[model samples]
Target: MNALSQTHSQGVVMTQAYLEIRDLVKSYDGKQQAVRGISLDIRKGEFVSFLGPSGSGKTTTLMMVAGFEMPTSGSILLGGREIAPVPAHKRNIGMVFQNYALFPHMTALENVGFPLRMRKTPAAEIARRAAEALDMVGLAAFGGRHPREMSGGQQQRVALARALVFGPDVLLLDEPLGALDKNLREQMQVEIKRIHRELGITTIYVTHDQSEAMTMSDRIAVFSQGVVEQFAPPLDIYQRPTTRFVGSFIGDSNFLDVTRQNDGLVAQGIGALNIAAPSQAGKFHGLVRPEAIGLWTGGDEQGHCVLSFLIEGLVHYGDSVLLIGSAAGLNLRARLPSVQASHLHEGDTIRIAWRENDMHLIPVQ
Candidate 1:
């Protein structure tokens, strides 16, 4: 099912679409399509992210929506009106590019006021609104400084302020935090989310970073090879991935090839696993998250599938440690709390267990 079809089942209400993309297609040559006939319905004031690797057509789709690129044959509807023929300048959409596309010579205030000046607003009103926009981004005092004088994070805030000063109906962010260092990138993520919350504008964020998309989006569209693998909320995409690509892309996963038998379902080396998922008849792959595996010290193993584990390597990640090992002739990765793993070492033999319902099933594809 597409993202929209799964929303109601997940208890999320579907309101009228504020931005509708119908069979949106884009092609350079007549033969190969960069973007296939993709469709989506986005509600107003929602934060939706387009997530994928490079050359996945996510940026192309965003450009088409912004009127920077025309669609080959499709419709882009905004507020129930078709806008595929509209010019970029007339669309009234705010855009923040990967690089903060600010003028080197212009002061921060002038950069923020450029949009209003284009529409021929009075000079005094431009100054007042520009100042307000700067203050909104927590950069009021830096207005006098040129782009060269500020830090990377500060320059990005200026770019964002400039985009919002005119109050555009939709905000499109194309990897706005790509240039910043890790700490600053995380800081900007929080700041941008805060601003989006306060303004409540319909937002389309484009990023290749899965963690960033997971943190900020109300829903994520996972694109791959000119199509969306799955578009759903963060947890849904992680817990119930509809495709093998999605299962590996979102987070760490271990997939086991399994088959159904007359007695029950069984993997090649790992005997019958007590998976309590809904029945779907066919060969399937079982998804087990590293953190879902639990260490069994002893006693009654009740309500768990116990298995022997041979530890081969260990990786310490401050709060948690990852145990790389072999279980039932298949490679396994298990995550444990730092305190619980303090005494564990490579070449150790141990027992691990996981609940029957914790094992998720995905059809082989």
Candidate 2:
């Protein structure tokens, strides 16, 4: 296991971890490492998402856990026992991929029952369980339909039923819903989250889509370069990211360079901030999420973290309006509710403010 995974006092072992990934490392060309020394413990019944950009090693990490990719160093524990050298079939982990990978010749019923049949399950039992799984995915009526006969979303659901019928220890998803349209993708996200909540299956999901990760994962392992930058709950990762990359990757944020001072640090163009966070001399980044800063239609800049900036633009985000403002040589992003946004417009003098603790410090390297 990686140092991070071993540091946990209690490794989650549900009905046997469904799956455990420890200190995984993978290199494609021998010199360039794809997956750095990464480690994560997926609890039996927990939904964890590996969210990162392409080539950031999220897929490789999942592959190593599933025995499709071998790690140069470290061990993967499934059911409390090590499985580094075990074959894929022996691992008994269910996997769902972006490509449905269903057989063109077989109907949905046959595809869903293939895994069970491979294990030589009784014909009667296989048919019964397959129907049940198909029903769970809302495809009971389309059992005889082939892959070509089903919609992208329906086909993906058949793939899900295929993975689930066997009741494997862990469910691994690698961009399983990427093929669907946006609306269908969103619907699938909710459907998957609902299924996970109901079944409490230990799941390891890999995706470069941040919104998907944030919406579905119980916790997220934010990967960059080749190593895991930070592993934290979604809210914590978004609100209080430990690294500059995490701040930039997880959500929408406005960053400004600052110089540390004894009492309060001086921001680039917004003047001094009265935040009480730790300060260093050289270079630091002040991160403020759009929601953390609100557009001020009329408020005096008496408190800390408040500034006067010209409203540059506004983008409506359904529930809230994103105000693009500028002040102190910095571009400000403030999110206000629709009601507040109605009162403000582009090119107006807009005031911006945040709480002392709403601002955080990340020493720039």
Candidate 3:
């Protein structure tokens, strides 16, 4: 059974998802499909991020799930029952946006109480719950301050409190922290994770920021042209990307276009040995993560695999240094800890090598 089906059987018991999308499809033009039949099962209390660049159809799919846009095909199962036609307010989904979306005229307290008021909650109870929500967001002292009176970060916290005041089972965020500066964004990312852990509410977050997605998602749905290219844990997406797009998206990588050779693909400058490349290996794409390549030492030394290179450039990255080199006519990059890189300098002749398993072979799609 799907996440929605399993969630509804227990009802109000705080089960996950209770919401799912099956073969969901959407299109703006009749001839061109935007979201091409996406399916997802979100468990209760899990945090999922739908991530991709602009035009990837991630936002469009998010709108459909939130009931703002209707899907052209397929079903939306809410608690195991179809809610494709369900009205927005009835879905009971909490939302926070990049703009903070707070009422400029109202104090944080009143702004947070808006949802409770709309639901006809008693005045006293509304105040009580709103204050609690503010407290949860570490903004209890800012309750009486209006949006204009608070800093951007404080306003964001107020927006978060407002979203949570309704106690919605699922929280939907649309680039909610995008407006913050780098340090603030990092701080809010931590805050958001902490909140998700504490509340245990299933969440759907959308963003184009890879670092944000990596730092917070329980599972990341990497989208490409409106389709999910990969959905996996952060490490898997970073170290074992299943596709070329994923390899380029999660982090920096060195790509070598190769042809099938014996048991492994033969890269231009680097020869190959036995390595169980992915099923799609023969098509001509090989991936080497920056960290996988290490300084090479030549000898007749035969082990896994090795490549000779001339170091062309080096970049310092605080904790590590990135070295750029050319191997067998292909450009390659290696990331080494600064401590280890301290001994190396420009134009150094180095042999870079990695285990056969360290390389990834990608399909031509």
Candidate 4:
């Protein structure tokens, strides 16, 4: 389902759409469509993310919204007005590309004030607004420095300042932090979120990074093969995904083919499951997150599924340990706290259990 349909189906009472994309489609070749009929209603000041792997139509959709690419079919409405005919610059939409895109010779202040100057704002006002914009991105003291003189993160801050100085109606960020190192990228994520909260501007961010989208967006649209697989809040997307693709895409997951038999659910390889049956009694793809499974100590197995896990591989992430193993002829991945898995090693057999309610059921497609 599209974003709007999914939201309405869930009984979510949303405010009027400030940015409406109705059946937006983009085709590079006359016969091959890059973006399918995708529709979404974004509320005013809401921060949404278009998330997917490379060439999944997320960027294409963002470009259409930015007026960089015209849609092959359907309409784009910004604040209840059609913006398809509007040129990119005249749309009053601020955009920050993957590359910082700051002028090498221009000072940070000059770069930030470029948009204002293009609009023919007075010199004094441009200078004041540029300084304020740099200050907002925590680059006030670096205004005199050129892009070449700054770090990747600082250059990114300048780009952000440039986008915000004009006070555009909406902001579109296309992987602005992709060039930064891990530590810097994380720092910029926090900074961007703080600025979003401060400005309260309607924003759409496009990224292939799942963690970035999960932590940054108010809602996320998961794109796949030119279509949105799912669009929802971060927690909902992770814990209760509507499709198997969404369940596997957002986080670490294990899928089990299950079917109803004699008033109970049974997995294909494993026997009868203790989990609650879904409302629909039919074939399903049972989604179990790795974190939901725990080491089975001596206790009641009521309302839980216990298995003997044979460890095949182990990966340590300092705080946690990921165990890749097989159980009941099914390959599974289980993540445990480092402290709990201290003695565990490859080729070891251990007891693992997961609560019945922790498993989410997705209809087979």
Candidate 5:
């Protein structure tokens, strides 16, 4: 028996952690680390996403949790017991990859039943359970179709079914929707979120796409340079990012370098601004979300930071319009509803204002 199975056998009452990762570090050649001392505690049914750019250690951390990569130092506790020493097969963790990894010759039913069959399940039980799994993924009618006979989206559903067929303790997905087109990718994102809600299984999804992570995950761990820069709910990560990298990564933001003045904070071109945040006297970055900026329609500008925007370009996104402009030596992007932007055009100088609190601060490093 593995450590987890042995822990269950010992009848010791363990903590309520469905999954726990503590101080995980992965180093190659003992010089540089891929995952540097990251820790997270996941509840029994929490849906968490590891979001970051390529080679930012999100995938490396997921691999460590799935037992595909060994951590140099740390503990992965599943069901309140350490599973780092357990073999991949013994860990009871299911994984779905980007390529789908289905057998070309085997039908969807056979593919979904492969895991149960490997565990020496009865033929009758495998057939029944496989059908149920396919039904769960809305693919009951496509069970007899082989991988070559199915579309990319259908094949991905089959892969998801196969992963969930055995009712594993945890599910790990590594960029599973990357192969589909934009429309299909969006459709799959909804499907995955629905399945996650229904199953309520502890899941860790790895993706470089911020939209995908924000749409599906209950909470996101933003990875950068082998560290988790911020881990919070999607809206929290989006609205109040703690770092400059996170602010730039998650959404369209204008970061203005501000200097602390005797009265308050000031930017080079925008003059005196209302800064309610307290910080040391030094340089800091003010994060201005694009949506927070709107056209200044002859208001008093009291309690708000108003600036003159020299419009450079415009992008129409059907429902919204993106205004790319410059203000006070800072290039800014502002998103306005199409209705509001209809009267505006390129090269028009307009006043733009954002709330004082909307400007979040990240100290310059």
Candidate 6:
């Protein structure tokens, strides 16, 4: 059992993780590491996303799991068995790439059944299973259609059906919807989630899109410079991020440098803040999400900090408005509902307030 499977502080014995990645590292040149020491423990039937920007090792790590790239060091255990030495074809792992990787010449049914045919399955069973797979992805009628005849979304569904026809032990998706338009990409996300729910397959998704990861995954591993910075559920990662990078990368944010001043904390250039201080009482970075700040309309300001915000810019997004400006030498951004900010304009000074509980503190690194 891995360390994560041990009994918790509450004396509950945790179940063993289905897949365990330990100290996985990859480097093209021995001197320069592309993937630094990375580790993750994923439970069975869990959808986990490796989220990061370009050259951040999210894709490299996914390739390592798919057996497309060899790791210079570390172990990948699936169902408690080591698979690092296993070849790509022998690992029984299915992968879908960003480009869809469909065979243009083959019909949809033929493409979906290709994996089974490679295994020398009976012709009759292959046809039946292929049809079932196509139907599962809502493409049974498109069986006779070739890749060129189908839309981008339809082609992606065919690729998904093909990957699952073989019933691989694990499924890895590397930005499968990256090529589609915004609306179609969102449609595919729902389709992928529905398919995952039906199969109960342990899946790993790699994407640089923050919203995609937030919407799809049961848990997310935020990757930066080849290292796993924070791995947690979506709400925890958003509301109580362990690091400043996780906060800034995941969404729009305003970071304030704060120092402990005797009994309370004082933000640089903003004077004393009323938010609760951390246990250590040292220099910290205070994160206040834009949506947390609201327009103050002269009421009891209990447990809230108020500021006079000079509106330098206003962005209208139909449902909401974003105000960008400085307050007492500190630049901040506040997002409010369009109805509340209907009369507001750029260059207007307004009173804005945020709840004390909404501020998250991170240790300065």
Model 5, residue 87: distance off in Å is: 0.6
- What is the overall TM-score of model 5 with all chains considered together? 0.93
- What alpha-carbon RMSD in Å does predicted model 3 have with respect to the real structure? 4.1
Error of 3 at 190 (Å): 1.2
TM-score-best of 2 and 5: 5
Worst 10 residues of 6 by lDDT: 2-11
Question: Whose lDDT is higher: candidate 1's or candidate 2's?
Answer: 1
Cα lDDT tens digits for candidate 6, 198-257: 666789999999999999999999999989889999888898888999999998999989
Off-target runs (Cα >4 Å) in candidate 5 are: 1-17, 279-281
Q: What is candidate 4's CA lDDT for residue 8?
A: 28
C-alpha RMSD values across all candidates: 6.0, 5.6, 4.1, 6.1, 4.4, 5.8
What TM-score should be assigned to candidate 4? 0.94
- The per-candidate count of clashes, in order, stands at 0, 5, 4, 0, 1, 0
Q: Rate the local accuracy (lDDT) of all candidates.
A: 0.86, 0.81, 0.82, 0.88, 0.87, 0.88
lDDT of 3 by residue, 6-114 (tens): 3332344743346688999998888788999898887777789999999898888888878788999988886676778988788878888889989899999999999
Q: How close is every model to the real structure, measured as TM-score? A: 0.92, 0.90, 0.92, 0.94, 0.93, 0.94
Report the Cα lDDT for candidate 1: 0.86
- Candidate 6 residue pairs that clash: none
lDDT of residue 117 for candidate 2: 95
Q: Candidate 5, residues 1-365: lDDT per residue as tens digits?
A: 32222322232233334888999999988999999999998877789999999989999999998999999999999987899999898888889999999999899999999999999999998998888888878898999999999999999999998988877788899999999999999999998887776666778999999999999999999999999999999999998898899999999999887788785888656667776546664777888899999888786777788888998999999999999989878899999999999988999999898887788888777
| Stronger candidate by TM-score (3 vs 5) | 5
Deviation from native of the Cα of residue 250 in model 2, angstroms: 1.6
